[model samples]
Each structure stands twice: as C-alpha cells, then as structure tokens.
Target: MNEKLKKKSAKMTKKDGYKNIPSVDELMSMKQSGILIEKFGRKLVLYAARELQSIMRSNANTNTKDISSSINSLEEIVNKYVLKDKTIINGTGVIIHTNLGRVPLSSESIKSINSVNSSYTDLEFNINTGKRGERHKLLNAYLNILTGSEASYAVNNNASAIMLAIKDIVGKGEILISRGELVEIGGGFRIPEVIQASGAKLIEVGTTNKTYIRDYENAITKKTKAILKVHSSNFSLKGFTSMPTKKEISLLAKKHNIISIEDLGSGLLIDTKKMNLPNEPTIQDSIKSGIDIVTFSGDKLLGGPQAGIIIGREKLIHKISKNPMARAQRLDKSALSALTTTLKHYIEDEHLIKIPVWQMINMREKEIKKRVDAIIEEIPNNVRRVKGTSKIGGGTMPEAELPTWLLSIKIPNINTEELLKNLRDLPKPIIGRINDNNALIDIRTIPVEFDKYIIQSLNKLNKKYK
Candidate 1:
C-alpha cells in the first residue's frame, strides 16, 4: 500500500476499535446493570452507562479487558453522583457536631416528625372551630411555661428570628450594639450584617473588650430604635473584657423608650453548670432580665429542630410576627412537631434523660470509658484506650471540654490518614480524628446502638491490613 493509504487504513482500524464499546442499550441489558438500576433509579444508571461509554471511547481502546473494566466502572460513576447525605457514625466526640446534623432528635421527637410527615396534620386547621387556624400560636403555651415570656414565635432559624425582629421594630432607625458583643454565628452570619440586611443602621459602640451601659446611652439619638446585645456563644473574651449585663442593657433601652433585643446564639433551656460544664445563659435568663425581645437557635443547645425562636413581651412579639418576613421564614409542620415534642420533654422535667443533646452532654466519663473498653476488647488490632476530651460543638460552648475516653488504633504499616479514610470507605462510614499519628475514635458523640457498626468496621480493617 502507499504511505498515505496505509496511514488512512491505520486510522480507520483505530476508529473501528470503538465499535466494540457497549451502547447504553447493551449495557442496560447486563445483569450487573439491572442490579445497579434497582439500587439507583434507571435514569441515573443510564446516565452513568453513557458516561462510561464516553470515557472508553475517549481512551480509544475497546479490548475485551477494557470493556469489562469499563462496565465495572458504571457503579462507581453512579455512586459518585448519588446523594452523599446519609446516616454516618460520628466518632468525633463533639456533641452537637454541626456537620453531622447537630442535635439529633430524641426518640419522641423523631416519632413526632415521622407521624407528622407521613400523614395530613392539623398544622393550620382549627378542628375545634372548623376553620383555618394559625400555626404560630401552636408553641405559645409550651414556650410561655419554659421561658416565662408573654408571647413566643418560631421561624426557620435564629438569624431569621433576629432579622424579623429588627426589621419590624427598628426599620430605618439606628440600633445600638457594643463592639465586643458583635458576634458572627455559624456560616459567617454576623450580627452587623443581619442588622444591615434588615434595613437598619448599625451604631457600633465602645471598645471590643469593654462596653459600659453608658456607651449604649451615648449612641442613642432621636433615630435610635433599639439596643442589640449578642452573646459570644462560639467564643469568650477573658481578662480586661467587660460588657454590660443583660439587665443593664434592658434598663438602658427602657429608659430610652426603645426595644431591647438579645440574641442568645445557642438557646439553652437546661443549666450547663449542673452538667459540670461552664455556665451558659438560658433563654429564661434573658427574659427574666427584662429584655423586651430574645432570639435563639432551637437546634444548637435547645436539642430541637433547626428553628429561630423569639420570645418577649406580648406586644413586641405580636409586632414581630406581623412582619411579612415571618411567614416566609416560618417553620414547617414537621419542624414544629419535632420542636413541640422537644419542648414537652423539658416541660415534663425529662430533658436531660430524653433529649439527645443533653443526654450526650450529661454522659458520664465512666460510662464512655466502659463503652471504649468494650470496643477495644472486640477489635483484635493494635488498639488501646486513651484519655481525651469531648467538646460542646456547634458554636455553643467554646471553652467547655468534657472528659472522655478514646479508642486509639495504630495498625502496622498504615498511616493515620489512610486508616481514617479506610474507615470512612466502609458501608457505614466511621468518622474519627487523628492524634499523634494514631486514629482515635471518641464514642462520646456516638450512641451505643452504633457500636456494633464500629466494631465490624474495625475488624474488617484489621483483617484487610493484617
């Protein structure tokens, strides 16, 4: 053949190689494909198959081995595109871990959620009057008993709660806030930004360390509408730091004939000092101090669904609830159901025993050590019991650390990072931390029911690594 013709023929042969690559129809006929289709829907499986075919064609190789390997890659592609939010074993010992779905609902709360989610509910229907009812009044009685507030409202989250309060009460007016009390909550949501978003002017007063009540008084003018006090929930300022008390701020706002609002970033119903942790002010404390309005999170320290709860005087709460944003930020039926159940736990004086957040917080060190000892006994590897600390995470308590026991695993010839990855790759991913080149599993955040999954994962790792 001529040189040009030879080159053309070679290119043709290479192009023909792709003819052996499986089509979407052919791939869908495979038994393995049927399994994947059953696990993931047909549409996803088909998309994965088409993607695999494209990859195989791009490589310009369609040998039998390559085709078989590409077929096996179908599941990998589908898994990669699948939803990643699933049940995970949190061995990270940080109770209320934000990334792991902070504040796991109690059994009662879960039951309430499932009950409300699976069927029609009286969410806004007034069965007593045979007419439509208001959902906002559902939690009033529960919150009134818990926080001693004249009225209460719940929105989607704490940020929304504060925003609604500011916009409704202080629109186009100056809101005084101490420089030290200006805090940024989780996800970079700052107090000043919230104020600005509400169309109100932010008057930052005093230094970052010290802000007397006089500073607030000095900042107030004819345009001043409210005084905002934000709790530094995720951080603490130590020596030389001084801010006015909640009572003082409330008194100052009263003297100026303006609103007083306090954002207790993580709202607490129970006392933390009783659990041997640092004192965190409760929602009731804010109300008792004569604050006209209080905002706090339901998911963080409250051990409820993600909600922004506002409690204050009847008139102030009524005004805030009348804002159009309140409807847009209101909680759904499922969240309200779960939150009501959670509140019931407190009302019945069973919060520490029934609510998962409090249960995890109040977990005794000896009980945690016992679980660690049992886990170490089950895993036949280079695992040892070690002392560690559990944190009250989710931007609640920055300085509180509870004593805990950890299972430190150091397998031969395996690095700590690789070990953690392997554990994560298991069916039920086990999330842990590294300590001094060793993999540490702190079971403080893990419930006892999930211990078997951890044991199984560790045993499987031991066998594979050994």
Candidate 2:
C-alpha cells in the first residue's frame, strides 16, 4: 500500500469515526428496527450491523464522525437488505422477461400458490383413495387434457426435464441432433452440454443452416437411441435455413424404432398462426405427429410458474419417472399448484384473456393507447403517446413483435438516463425504454391494476426530479 494511504488508515481510531458506529443492541432498540426484527429476526439485524461496521471502517476517511450519519448508514444498510429481492415494474415492454421473473402468474394461480404454501396440502397423498399418491398427478392430468399427451411429468425447469429424459431413455447411447439445433439458451444452458451431462452421446448432423430428414437417417446407427430436436426459441436463422419437420423426423424415428424427443423450449399451446407471428412449435402438434416425447417450459409461453413439463407416450414417461433424477428435479407443491391452476385455465379455454402472457400478446394496440391516454391525461404536462412494439421475451418468439403504444415522457431538464434511474427508484419502480431522446413506457406490459400507480409515479417524478 502507498505510505500516504497507510498513514490515513492508521490515523482512524475509535475516537475518530469508529465511535460513531452503533452497537447491534442499540440499533435494535429503535422503533424502526422493530419492523425489521419482526421480518428478519435479531440475528440478521446483527449481521447487517456488522456489515455496516465493516463498510464504515473501510471508508473511515470519508465517513462523518457523527452518531446520526452512522445511524443513517445503518438504516440504509438495513433497507437495502430488506428490499434486495423485491419485485419491480416491467415497463420495458418485454413480456415473459426472464430477468424480471418470466410470466407473471394469474391471480387465481397466485392464490393457489399462497393456499398451497400457507398450509398443509395433499401434495403427495391421494385423499380420494386414502393412500400415498404421486405429486404430479393433477399436473399430468391437466397436461393430458390440454395437450392430448398420453402422460406428463413436471420438473423444476425444461433443462432438468431434458436431462432426466435423456438420462433415462438414452444413457450412454447416441442422440442424433441437428447442428443448427444445438443452441445455447439463457444462462449458458446449451443443448450439447445438457445432453452430455445426461450421460448421452451427442451426434451432430447436417450443417448449421440446414438439416434434412436424410441427415437424421444417415446419422442413425445401432447405437442411436433418440433423435433430439430442440426449438431455437431465443434466436432465428433466416435465409436459406432449413430443418426437418417434426412429423418427418418422428416418422423416421418410428421406422427406425428409435425415440423422437422434441424440446419445444417455450411451450406455446395457443395457435398464433393467425397472428402472422413466426411459427413456434407446440407440444400438441409434436405429440399428435407421433413424437415420442415433448418437453417445454411452463414459465415462457405456457404462462405458468417456472417449471419443466414433459408430456409424451406413457411408457416413456413412466421410464423417465423411475429415474432417480426425477425426484431430485421434481416441482414443489407451490409450483405444481400454480401450474395446475394455469393449465386448468388453458384446458377450459379461458386462457386467451386470463393468462398474463396471452393477455399481453393478444392486447389490442387501441387498448394500449387507451391506457396510455389515461396516463397522459393524468400527467398532461410532459408525457405524450407514440407508436412502439413489445417483445415476447424469455427466449420465445424472438422475431415476433406486438404493436404497442408508448408514453413518451419529457421532463423539462432531466436527462434520459437520470430520469429513468429516478423512476426506477420509486416504490414500484418503473422500467422503460429510451427512444429518440425520450423515455418510453409501453402500457401493454403494464397491468391495469397498476394504472393509477404508474400515473401517480410519473406525477411524483415530475415534481421530485424537476
């Protein structure tokens, strides 16, 4: 260390700035700390106090040698810990945003989650028969009712579902997959890595841009146990790109007596073909086409909690269920409860407008404009409406765009970045896009329940930031 820095460090003592730091017992005695104690107990508060002391000592030169500043710093540290994992608004117009907790569950689903989590549930017991039963029975039943799959299973996420299936069906056997379909999903989850981790051999066929049915046929050997087709959900390859259809590959698998497994990553059950959106495979289509197994995500287009759903032939699903990894990667009671309610909505044909993801996708531009107009009417000074687009994020429908209307806010002297940052610091922070030197908030992604909140937030922003 530099001599001057060492001298500065040495100059700090208990009398200088260290004396200002509060004791854990002293801070806990305050009325504000009562709320924290009820929420996070005394141990955590003590831990926060120790962390504050460490930070205060490290910056002793800059820290004010006063009890009030130290108490303020302690309160700031406590508040930071309290709100570290709180939810925020997703005004960025990305539906199913992975970073912001993909696919906000419906009110019914949320209630189911709370119900199952708040009390004891029949999660693993069959009350009808008064016997031990499987946990995924209701979930599987809904998947079968909604997608016509003979059987189904629910795991923690799609990757674990794929891994469990491969480990059970094709362990130490060759899995024929297209070179183009070997994709890396969010958080560095690559198809090849998942396959290898499942103890299966990956045999890449065809080229990056194209893979014909003949490619799969040629790659098949005695060791090949499964033909894996992964939907490139997060990205699209345009221009001269080609891959074998699920039907064609399933037919080939049938002829060869090999398994055909398609990982329809973002599990869209709704027919969006009428919407002119880019084609995304559905579990129903793959299962109807004789695909042996289809796996997908519950959080993405399924509009459910984070889960990996496996639906396929009963024999294959039974085999997968027997694997030890099935228990290790199984969904908890709360997630299954939420997923069951979500699938019930889909099965009853009520999800077109009930599910948040579908509601956002099918939301009319006029509807968004109406909401935007309401916001602008409330805060008429600096906000105006403009045309914009929203994305079906969370690695699904990468090329699909929903026409949306956005609120273009112009606070007189506030720069775009600072304005956005300040909005993000609110009680329910607003996240928006910066376009043409203005902050744009898409109303399609914002729920109607938060309409007044958004309006009040913007008005408060106008006054506070200015």
Candidate 3:
C-alpha cells in the first residue's frame, strides 16, 4: 500500500467513514437520477444508497479523496439494477438463446397478454353460462384444434407438467423408460430425477446406445403405471444407435393397459418439413401414435410465453388435470393469454407472417445478405461480410443449422474481446458471437426493426475510436 493510503487508513475510524457517506437524497439529485427513479422507483434508489454506504465503509481504509469518481460509481451501480430485466439485441445467431430469454413472444401474443392483464378477464369464469369455469379451459379448444388432441391442459412449465402427470398416474409405481432416451437437458434437468421427484420409480431398460421393444415389454410388471418416452432433443447418438419407435412403445403400453406419456422437450408445432428442415415429431403425430399423455414446452419452437402444454387422450388429460398438484403448477392469466394467441396463429395459419422463430428459421441467404447490405451501407468500414450459421437453440435441434450471412467486426485499436464487451455494455446491449478473432453478428437473429439501433451503436463506436 502507498504511504499516504496507509496513513489515511490509520487515521480513519469506521465512524469517520460513515460520516463521509452521502445521503440518499443527494444521490437522487445527480444527473440521470430522474431516469433511475423512473426505471427503478425511489425505493430502489434508497436501497442503492445504503448498499453504496456499506461499500464505502468497507473500503474506508483506502482512497476516498475523489468524491466525484465515487458518485459516478454509485450511479453505475443504480443503472445496472434498473437494466436487470431489460431486453438486449441478439446479434448472436443462437435463436431461442436460453441465457437471453428463450423464445421471444410474437407481437400478437404480446397484445393478447396486454389485453388480458390490462383489465378484468374471464380467467376462471364462463361468460357463456354465467358460471365458474376452469382456467385451463381457455387453451383446451386451441390446443385440440392445432394438435388434433382430444383434450389439453396448461401448466407453468414442462417440468411441472411431467411431475404432475407422474404423481397422478404413476405415483409409487414404475415408469419404464429407455436408458438410451434418458437425457440431461440445459439447467441439468435429468429425466430420471424428474421421475423420482414425481414419486415414481424409473425402470431403466436396455443399453445406453440401443433399446429394443422387448426391453420395455420385459420390464413391465403389475406395478408399472406408464411407459415414458423422452425425446433427446438436445443431443443425438450416432452410428449403431437404436431405440423403440413410438408406435412400438405405444402398442406395448396399450397391450399392458397402462398410460403412455411422451415428453417432447421443445414442443415444436410447425412441421420442420415446411421450414425445409428434418422432421421433429409433432404433438399430433404423438397423439396419432397412441401416446395417452404428452407434455411439452410452450416457449421453445412454439415461440410463446413460458408454459407446459399437456394434450392427449381426453380421459388421461382429465385425470392429469384432476391431480391436486396440478393446481400448484397452473399457468397464470398472462401465460395462458400468450399461449392461446400463439396457438391461434398456428390454427389460423398466420404464424408464417406473425411468429418470429419460424420466420427467422426460414430466412434465406439472399434475405440475410440484403439485411447485411443495409447495415453495411450505413457503417461500412471494418465490417466484413461472411458466410456463417445460426442455430435453433433452447435445447432443440442441437444438430440443425441455418445458413446465413454475418458481419465480422475488427475495431482498429481495440482487441476483439474488448470490442465485444463494448457492444455488450451499450445502452441496448448488442450480443454477438466471437469467431476467428472477430465479433460476428448474425443479422438473421437481428430483427429488421433494430437495424437503425445497430447502425447507431456502430456509428457511436466509430466516433469513439476516431
């Protein structure tokens, strides 16, 4: 430590440090304080002041000569808390990016959410009969229309849906699942753990690389409640891998008179073929294949609010809905509203024009190049065009890649990492992938509406560098 720092530390008592702490009202009068108050309210400003006071006390032993610099630090701290829930630009080509809010809700869904949340809604009331109604009933018709299922139920998330299903139908009973199909998705949610949490015993059958129909048949006992099939959406096993088909497993479950549930992790509603990609089995296909109960996520591939949709045989769905645990996992009015609109887009065949996920997935190279050209026209220097790939993220289609155009940036005096950090630290953070010692921004993931913001951010960077 410097001699001056040492002497200053020796002279300052903890009480002396407290005396230097600024009042919350003093911070409230600083530049950008009104913006902070509007963003986080006065309550958070006071909280931030106390936090800063604590930090000042702890660091009292060193450097307190620059009061202006310390105030700036406190202002920065307040801004960070205000931006905690703000949206950032996804220049990173990973669509449905988990870390950055998986599945951006469509505008129509947002409208629906706003409409429902702005005022009183018929959340649990039947306007038709002037009677109390079920909350899940709102999605039942839309789900059945889009999925060809006899009935449907809504929950807060896929994990809760699965837990309720098992606790209702397979409590303390055995659930036969293929060892090959056992998967650990993002956030470390393992299939076996979920089953165990639901009070069901997992009956692992066959090898990790292969499982035959007979493997499941052999494992079935009088205690067996269901045949559980988990779609390993996040990963795949190549070469010499085999697992029982949905048809085979469904037939086996039918013969045994037990429930069959398929956990379609991504819950893709659109046919991948229509998007010029390989097929992911749709909920309709699962129902046709005799899956008695099906649970899937609403956000991934569906491009809706976070939810778990359960749609299958009417009897089984009713039974699952009747579970006491279902109430604990029920969807709120906002989620239900968003999900209903999202499903309606599919039913009305308006998703192609309305849903962002499918629109981005089907983006052509020519279209992406046009977007890139538009961006380059504004800020041309150091922005190199290149061929790159985007992904269908959110633990779905781990192998699927979308061909696209990308902008690789090289700021003259700054390292790529620092440049990337600068973009991320912008007022509206621009998130991009680092490739080949450059920051690669995939325009496919960037909405056309944000093009001006991207240009403005780059222009500001250019000015700063100049």
lDDT of 3 by residue, 1-466 (tens): 9999977767766557566666666666766566667767888776777787678777664424445555667776776676464878999899899899886888989999899989999998989999998787758988888888999888988988888888888999999998898888668988889898899999999999989999999999999999999998888788999988888888999999998999997988767886667568777789888888999999889888899888888888888888888887888889999999998889889887788888888788899999898888899688878999999989888888889999888888988999999999987899998988998999998889999998889888877887
Q: Rate the local accuracy (lDDT) of all candidates.
A: 0.89, 0.87, 0.85
Candidate that scores best on lDDT: 1
Of the pair 2 and 3, which is ahead by lDDT? 2
Runs with alpha carbons beyond 4 Å of true place in candidate 3? 1-42, 53-69, 83-85
lDDT of 1: 0.89
After the best TM-score superposition of candidate 2, give how far the Cα of residue 90 lies from its true spot, in angstroms.
Answer: 1.9
**With candidate 1 superimposed using the best TM-score fit, by how many Å does residue 411's alpha carbon deviate from the native?**
0.8
Badly placed stretches (over 4 Å) of model 2 are 1-41, 56-68, 83-87
Residue 278, model 1: Cα distance from true site in angstroms: 0.9
Candidates sorted by lDDT, descending order? 1, 2, 3
User: Worst 10-residue stretch by lDDT in candidate 2?
Assistant: 61-70
Q: On residues 22-102, what C-alpha lDDT tens digit does candidate 2 reach at each position?
A: 665666676766666788777777777788778866665444434445557666777776746466888999998887888
RMSD (CA, angstroms), candidate 2: 3.5
Q: Write the per-residue lDDT of candidate 1 for residues 1-466, one digit (tens) a residue.
A: 9999999987886688777777778888888888888988999999999898888777764445344555568888998889976888888888888888886899998999999888888888898998998786658999999999999999999999999999999999999998997888778888888899999999999999999988888888999999998989899999998889999989888887999999998989877676778889999899999999999999998999999999999998988888888889989888999999999999999998999888888999999999999988898778899999999999988999999999999888788999999989877888999878889999988989998888888888888889
For candidate 2, give the lDDT of residue 14.
34
The count of backbone overlaps in candidate 3 is 0
